[model samples]
Target: MAKPKSGAKKATPVGKTGAKPAAKKDKSSRLDLIKNASKRVATTTTKVVKAAGDAPAKGSKSAAKKAAPEAEQPKEKVSEKTAEKASTKKSAAKAAPAAKTATAKTAPAAKAATGAKASSGKSGSKAAAAPAVPAVEKPRPRATKLPPPGEPLTKREMEQLLTAGEGRGVMGEGSLKGRLVVLNEMPNLVVVGRDKRELTFLLQGPDQEVLPAYVNHKVSVSGMIRKTTNHGGVVDVRKYSAKKPEAEVVEAPPADTEPRLRYLSPGEVSMVTAAGMGAGIKGFAAVRGNLEMTGEEFVLVVSNGGTRQQVSFIIDGKAAAKGLRKNVGHTLQVMGVVDKTSGWGGRISAENVEPRPSEARAVSRDEMELVHIEGEVPTSVDVKLNHGLTVRLPEQPGFTWAIEPTVAKRVGLREANFEPGPNGGPATREFFFTPRNPGTFEVEFFLAKALAPGLVDRSFKINVTVKP
Candidate 1:
């Protein structure tokens, strides 16, 4: 370093003292140039940010233009190529935010696809990788329509009705038109539905009275039916009407053909007893009655409107036994001949035995005998054949009256009427029966006490003789 002279212009080193005024002025100008350039950049960056904020979530081209805002180049000027490069860098930066926003907008759709698989019990990674499609369901089978009412049921149709269950339109609901063939006139009406097939049925309600008049005649029957075992069932007849004769002959066989054996009425069979057994009685008799089986013996106790009688029969070996077991509560037709010593009583040889359709009505009070029974019972009581036997029982508390099962089986439960007593102790019970056969029966009456549980109170025995 050299020492400077005083009062003379010192040759000061450039770094030793402060810079020159002209040099300072040039520096200030350079600084002002830089400041202006920075201000322009800041203003352009603010404009770009404002444009991006105002744009939709899916952004617009305006945002991109604002991102590379051409900062008015400093008045000092710059190369065109360099300005283009700077603009490109700013454009890339702004495009990056738009791409991020687009990705964010599509995030819900991607998450929905992933969630579908995840709900289907798949792992998160697998759910995110693949998706599933929904499935469709199958339809059900259709139903079948019923056969025409006027036509007869074929073998297949009959079998279908026989084996039909709920929902099978086999014995389809609604009215059925057919020829009514009455088989028996007894405690209940029994008849055959003679359409394409002979369907046996028990007549019920007011229709029972209506059918007896039109036996062996063509008619239209309306009712509800519930299927039973075998090919037969019972009809709950609601209404019935007589069909025209032309309708009956529509499917009728040849006129010269031998007709089916006609069943006899209850009154006709009872008239047989007055005529007695003889050579002329060898003809077929269609008698209606209750069929009872005791060991090897088969007996029928027939009932007339005014009387009842017993008729024994020999079973035909050639007869079909398809529905024989279900005929206990049914009225049956015994087509046979009358003889003296065929069974325990007067016997009739049964050529054909089957369930018969009939119109059953209750016995009138005029044909009944009222007998009051109390503490003591007589040794024997006389009951006229076919006449109603009404036994009046006294009302007592905690006591019930019943006949023995065997006696009830031989006779019948018939009808029991219960009426309220004067002081409401219990009830006055009236039991009725019409003796069919001429025999001495030991009827056991049981007085059951409520306190004894299973034990019976007092048992009274009585001998009843049905007159010939």
Candidate 2:
């Protein structure tokens, strides 16, 4: 015990000052630990209170307290570090609910904003989204009226209606009315406008049968107007109304005579042209007239005695003798077959010809020299050379007859003398000549207006022969 080692515990002295000071130091430390623990527990409690205020229903507060009781019992042996860790965990859990609540509240605003943008797209575009509107229509103007019926269209009117181009509708399309003349019966029906400038038509449809009853008579015809190469109108008839003739001629002929072999009138020939010739007609086709050579055919010009209705017959061959060209004015009877095959209307294929019987009498040369043939004449005649020849001219009404003086001088014949028939009737003329030689001579006879001074007339050329 002399001197205790420095590292060993030493005994305390029983002094009042030393003991009081030691005890006081110990108390101060205790109080300081209590204060620190109290501060930590207060901080934890503040966090728990705030979490409950923010999200009381998110989790159970009792469970949080049971799991960590560091704040409830500050006297426990738990470490400061442990208490701090538990408080941190509680704060984290509480903060998680707060963050979720904030996120849930903000999500609806974001969704609402997105919906607004989508709705604007559907209704905002103008041209692409709008409905369509309908358009209104305009009306047209009417057309002008056509010309009156039965009236001949003027040159200007015709020019306006017709065209030089081919086809039926060249004369624009329309209806027309005019006088009808049926040119033929059944099978092929043809008609024409007698007063409407003789506009020809080709009759068709159910109304065609009614047209034959109106032949050579006046009637009103209605149909569609068309054109042809003949410059005549063609109608597709729909209806017709006939005006009865003033007089009707009914002729009953001998029985059993064939149609072709019977004599045909001028009107019949015209009908044949309109209807067309079926097969062939054979019989004597006789005509009395002066002969004329036209192209490769001979034309016989005739005038019916009573009516003076003129007609022409086309012959196929030449009928000229060596000196007969000068006798072309002399009348002769030509007999042959009349058929439609050769020429326009009808043709006479002459088989033989001779002077008319009344003019065929032979005269003695002495009597011919003494006779002064004048005033009127026999219808036709023949003569001998070195003797005078007398010709008889017929009465031709509604006509002024004449002969060329130059022709008489050229043929060595005396000038002709004319004698008119009684009471505004026909007129006649005679031709006489002393033949100096044997030959044929031709003469031209013409018809002209009574007072007209010009060559506006139709002529007949005849051939005469002087026998030796």
Q: Give the best candidate by lDDT.
A: 1
| Candidate 1, superposed: residue stretches over 4 Å from native | 1-18, 53-62, 65-287, 290-468
Give me the runs in candidate 2 sitting further than 4 Å from their true place. 1-220, 223-257, 260-331, 335-337, 344-468
Tens digits of per-residue lDDT for model 1, 1-468:
766656778666878767677566854554454455556655655554445445543343445443443643432242333244443444334434444454344344334433453445446557678767577654322112222344344565554554423213344344555556655451122333322334554545444555667765566665554346344555556667775455334567788996554444454345553322221233456666665433233445453111112233434434424345445435678666544342123566666887876446466657466444554465677877777666666535644455654576565446544344444244555667777788888877666542122357776677778887
Model 1's TM-score against the true structure: 0.25
Per-model lDDT: 0.50, 0.48
Cα-based RMSD of the predictions, in order?
Answer: 21.4, 23.9
Q: Report the lDDT of model 1 for residue 295.
A: 28
| TM-score per candidate, chains pooled | 0.25, 0.21
Candidate 2 — what's its lDDT? 0.48
